[model samples]
Target: MIEVIDEFYSAALAQETIRGMIENARGGYRNGGLPVYGYQNVRSTDGNGNQKTRYEINEAEARIVRLIFELYAKGNGLKNILMHLNDHGHRARSGGLWNKATIASIVRNEAYIGWTIFNKKDTKIYGIQFKPRTEWVIIKNTHPPIVAEQLFNRVQALIEERHPTRTAARTTASTYLLSGLMTCDRCGSSYGVTGYGRGKKYAYYNCLTYSKKGKQVCPGHSIRADELDAMVIAKVRERLFSEFNIRQLLNDLNVATRTVKDGRCEQVKDLKRRLADKEARLLRQYEAIESGKIDLSLIGDRLRALKAEQNALREELANFERETMLAPPVITRAIIERYRQEMEQVFIGENVQEQRAFLKNFIEKVVVGESETRIVYYAGGIRIPSGIFPATSEHPRP
Candidate 1:
């Protein structure tokens, strides 16, 4: 019975997703997330006052789009195009230099030629598994085209002829430990992952500007992922999970709880105001009944109800005040030891993705120089568990 119900729920969710996507596509509306780099989302109202997101060309970005298509058509590979863009100071929509995958995505995106394609991947499964092209919902000329259909098709042909199925380093993009977290110590441009393929997965997050824009912009610097991931993991386990650091974590937790407690204090204040208002109303009612202005037989139930509400408010207010007065929990030795063990397991565990996530949370930014890598800590920072800077630890590049 549970399995049957779960299957039904899965089917219903898939249907709803497809239906909503198709509806949005047919109506020429841009669905959520970031719009393609060449386009910006403009909100428009229909006759019935329904606000719809419409894709409008961002002229500056469109020029970059046209240049990319033209360059690709002129026999430039993804790396060459990426280098050209970075060398010329052209940044991605997210304020980063163009990687090979970014360039490939722009080339393959149907929106360039004004088509809205949906259902590219099956979302019903536990992991993202892409659906075949035949299973897609494609609407033509949904918005203005950045490039001609002829040019777009030519680029697609070139991509197929050159790369086949976009294998090599691109396929292993997710496996890199420090893909997005590291930045160059010299120029501050992000590090791009490369140097992996041909059955041997050699991982390195090299400086982007150095790779694409030449050494003039930023020096050629690269960090070995396996060694650095190990070192950083060790440092985080030793320092971040230490009793001193756990105390900072508890402080952050207390600060967040205090915010909630302050909100409760305001709630208690509001309850008191409400109780006072109820009492004033009761007094006015008593005076009226005593003066023979209102009949007791008629107003007696209302007076009783007002008194009941007043009592309820008083009880609620007292509970809230008591809660507000309670002190935040202290960081105990047991908590620190337990947290240390759990954190050690997280790093020691085989989940690279999980390790990266935790690293990004505690470590503010990792600045890799020619000689040493500097890690800035936000041990008391981040949302939920805010942090203070414990230390800016540096280690020689392995």
Candidate 2:
């Protein structure tokens, strides 16, 4: 505990120091970092008598900023803009000629429009990473505006149109039930939904390796997505997840669990120890806040995280105790029957996510061949159980 407390305070001091500096930087107060081009960092003392830095527009540089926006919006590419700026009497604040990246960055920066942001990124052990915009502290109208908001919006639209991003919309827009489970038998590549139909509304599951690399890599094997999905769902519902199969699987699980009760005491003790540690750490943070050893605002995020961990630990500890002391649920024939009925409704229902879960539970993977498909079951799950499906197009039994 002594060594742990020392290490925690060292980390806490670093966190608190960085957060205090960011809090002081809310209204464009600089922290010795280079200000964006067209803005100069000027030092001044705040009302607290502590010296700080904030951005003020450098007019000579501001004119150059406005010119870049105008030129880009007029259909000028980065190359032309770069050449135009360097050929003329313009250079970076470092007195070096401007490059394409420098020119492009000025056009994209929001600092020119008089809004300053702080805590937009965090530095972890790996490297710098951007925080979500909601977490960023944005102070508007803090400095004099150089370019109009209208110009910035126009430039942004052009930038997005030229270099479009993928999967921003398509990720949620396209959902497949057997996505992770379905694979091609020929090349062992996963089948994913691709292409649009006559009205750009329908898609198909094409072999990923073949679709990406062409027929020279593999055959152009494609299947109508709806047909394959319906067939697989039917097979899973009628064959694999049948009530007889459900009952036998539960019986097997209950028998297996009865023999495995000897190894749980150590797990319970370990969880109790972990739970106690989380509670102690949470208490320390609370004491620090009450005793004035730490600022609440600086430690609020960490405090919430610790409280969440405490809650999760409590839930886990309860589960471990219940499992060790109390018996497992009496999984009777009536209980299995009720579960089977609910599963039937799950497949027939409109909730695709629920249906997907049930399918993944019953079957491990589906290997799609030219003439047939193979459904692999989780072991000890279904009767007629050699532990694998061993079915073809002519005869696919559950």
Residues 311-361, model 1: lDDT tens digits: 999888888888888985665667767877897787778887987887877
Q: Write the per-residue lDDT of candidate 2 for residues 161-191, one digit (tens) a residue.
A: 7663722333231377777887787999887
List of clashing residue pairs for candidate 1: 380-386, 380-387, 380-388, 381-386, 381-387
* Regions more than 4 Å wrong, model 1: 1-77, 80-171, 197-201, 247-277, 294-315, 318-331, 379-398
Winning model by lDDT: 1
- For every candidate, C-alpha RMSD to the true structure in Å: 14.2, 20.4
Global lDDT of each candidate: 0.75, 0.71
